[model samples]
Target: MKSNTPLIGILTSSKSDGSIAGNGPLFIALQKKLISLNGISFVFIPEGMEVDCINGYSYSPEENCWKKKSFPFPDLVYNRIPFRTKEQEETSQLLFSRLREKNIPFFNPCFIDKYELYQLLKTDNTLRDHLPETILVKEKNQLLAFLKRFGGIYLKPTQSSKGKGIIRVRMEGPSEILLEGINKQEIYPSFTQFWEEWNEELLKKRYAGQEEIESAEYEGKRFDFRILAHAHYDNYTLTGVGIRHSQEQEITTHIPSGGKLLPYHLFQSSEHDEFFQTIISIIGKSLSEQFGFFGEFTIDAGVSKSGRYYIYEVNSKPMSFDEVDIEERKIENLCRLFLQLINAYPQEKNA
Candidate 1:
């Protein structure tokens, strides 16, 4: 028997006009790919408004009555919610909970619930080995100790993306550490110097916020890998891989920090070929078993001078597609994998 056709809903944030932010370039790419598939319909949901379940699209509050149409309910939701403030964060959680109670299939139910990801990884010893030295602490003593032991470290907000609110600390000498803002690049000689400089930068002289210190190197040119993993049928596959190289003095390879994305083949060499394949396989297995959410995920990983790959952070919802010279087969494989996952849900549920 043929399976039921799936109606996928993309839940995204609204612009000031209340329309969906679904027209972004990356999102457009995904939409185009999905549209190419047979028997699939796409619906959109914007925050702060109830969508109509008759039509497949909704209108913004700012639009005139003619544009204010109700959209149809979706069989599955692809969450693309962006959190800008504490209240928006809470609102997203509530919306996700409602979707769950309604029994709608969703990928990345809520991005704000990253604590669950951390908790899942904490118990996996083998997976933990691939991660860098990490700890959660709010005390200055803990930060100082981390800096002392690692010689260099990165201070980042627990809930930050695109490398915002990140600071890098490097040991300049036996007794001094150089602290610099990730974006501002303001330099300081010590923690006390950092406080003074930070106060001057903000012009209010107050403690900024909680920052997690991570051991990251900034002196050398750094590159990061974007490992795209997706579930196809019952197996998970690593789709297109890409590299991001820092073009500035930032310790991170995030695009916002003046980084450029390179093709995955750039890293494929006689020396690194074997290592790269092994790491990708390990990452795919780890994520599938840990999260239990079999969908496309982007894993950002870094390589040290010692030739070891360290998992930086796993992004549950990665930027969809980029305009690169990727092979047609790769793109087809990715699209096929996405459809496979969408198709597998009902079969798995029945079994």
Candidate 2:
């Protein structure tokens, strides 16, 4: 039996390649799932993208690209815009304003901000304990002041990802400061000298000072959990959890930084499995409620030696899920999220 299935648009930063597979493999799996479920799918870019002024494109399954078949604007938008500054671009912002004017429902209402998230969640009694001491470094003095208190801290670019621009710092003595391994562990005689040369340049860019969190280690390397969580409106669930072990020289669990990914089930030493899921579910739900209408996220959480979990970071525009069998399940969950969103759109618009 034929039915009027609602269309879904998978959006990202990749430009049109005149082929169907424009948005990458994650969406390919998602597109298949949507089509199998009797829903239409098309991938598009926001740059130079005309939502055709209330128009859309068709998914050419053979070519794996949207190509140029005319349709209506999608019933829901799965925004996968990856760059931190993409939303800040005039054209991108214009696109968002247009989407709003069109009254289209989209996931991830706002871009992810590391410091902004901490400030918002700090008041939550359930999550505050898991957060490390984090503050924005608007002035050279502010970062240095934080250092004096913490003894050692990490300076991170607020808008950066993939463990880039992570500077490890500590004071050698009252007048001396040590910067760990940017080039080499260099020592400065005074904080002012350190500020003029290093801190001054860093201050020009937005950074946050966080107390160095001592995460749980396995086999002599520090490790953390990359828990995959999904939300359908207000309902949330912990879908997947993987452990990322940091490299010996650095303190990040990012896969791009030479960190290794391991299945959570394979880790014999992890805290009670239920404990990890409980923490991730609570954190995930808080984020979904704070920001409305989203499907998935990667909550980067650390475990202390005592098996207590701490949430270090969250990725809204997460890297594609790579675990075995998890990808298909994510697409299934995503379709459910879209179905609920599509069903509720009219009521939301009327109300």
Candidate 3:
């Protein structure tokens, strides 16, 4: 392999994703590591990719990865694309196809469906113990059975995040049913009323019926642990953990939906530390084996009021949170993993 700086392209939704502003400095960490080879560049590969005319953004506005001009494809790619970027649907697919044809090393080659993962992981002996009872909501019978058995349940969309389309249902009696949504919630006088309205909606979109864990809470809000993990050599390393506390009376602790993100250390006094870490290790390995390749994942897990730990969700393309330390470690690992991948796939021209 020739000695030359490798360019790393980060796939993102927009040209100026200020959300990633936090990791801007850490990109320099990559440059420092590659000083002997020249230096490294962090580029943002945005939506609306043009054929052969593909353009990317540099961390600075004046570089080749900037939006000012078209640039050559990078040596490695880190897909940060949100599965729901409706505007870039067709182009994104084409771009990925091209990347594969070029043999470029990239992670998260495709988006993962929540239902697909729920079914696959929940069956694993190692992961099932930490997985809450989750089932795809295929019919009215399933939802009713879960609510009746668990007394409280959640209907979560199989393709959503940020707590969108999460409906909390609880039965007070045969006649009284509570239906809680994102912005507003209500109680129906009868099961018939709740079923008539909700049945049609739930049937329209695929959902997962999850037994709601009355999680351990601090103050008045329920919280879940977000374990940020990334692939390291042959194993997964925990970048860090952060706590997402629910909004007052909210069913989910998604930060965008008003949930609070506290550093994981706040829960240091709890006795489940080892369990939580173990769960992360198992999941990271399990997902890697299942998916073939994974760069990073955010696991939404928490401890129950009864001291049981359960994993609620796994995000393959997790967004960066606003925490400085966690974001730094996450970016550091990303660059490290990119170097590993890039070095392994040296240019055939040089080979």
lDDT, each prediction: 0.55, 0.71, 0.72
lDDT of 1 by residue, 44-135 (tens): 44454353243334322234221334444555666666554422565566656665565555665434223344455556665565665655
Clashing pairs in 1: 52-71, 53-72, 154-214
Return the clash pairs for model 2, or none.
19-65, 20-64, 20-65, 21-64, 21-65
lDDT of 2 by residue, 1-351 (tens): 213687787766643453322346776677778878888776665654554533335556788665554445667888877665655677767766766766778877556678888887787887898888999887777877898998889888878776778878888866798887533577889888888887655767778788977666888888887777777566676667777877746556677667887777767453546665666567666777787655677777777777667778888777765576666667788888888888887522211
Candidates 1 and 3 compared: the better one by TM-score is 3
Angstrom error at residue 342, model 2: 1.3
Global CA lDDT computed for model 3: 0.72
Q: What is candidate 1's CA lDDT for residue 33?
A: 60
| C-alpha RMSD in Å of predicted model 1 compared with the true structure | 6.1
As for TM-score, the candidate ahead, 2 or 3, is 2
Relative to the true structure, candidate 1 reaches a TM of 0.74
Instruction: Name the regions of candidate 3 deviating beyond 4 angstroms.
Output: 1-3, 14-39, 42-53, 61-67, 85-88, 269-271, 349-351
Q: Write the per-residue lDDT of candidate 3 for residues 1-351, one digit (tens) a residue.
A: 333667766665543444432244444444444443444554454453555444654544234232344555668777766556532477766777677777777786556667788777877787788788887877767667777889888888888886778988888876698888777789999767888887767777877888878888789678888888888777777788888888765778887778887877778754556766666677777766786567778888888898878888888877767788887777678777888888787654211
Error of 3 at 26 (Å): 9.1
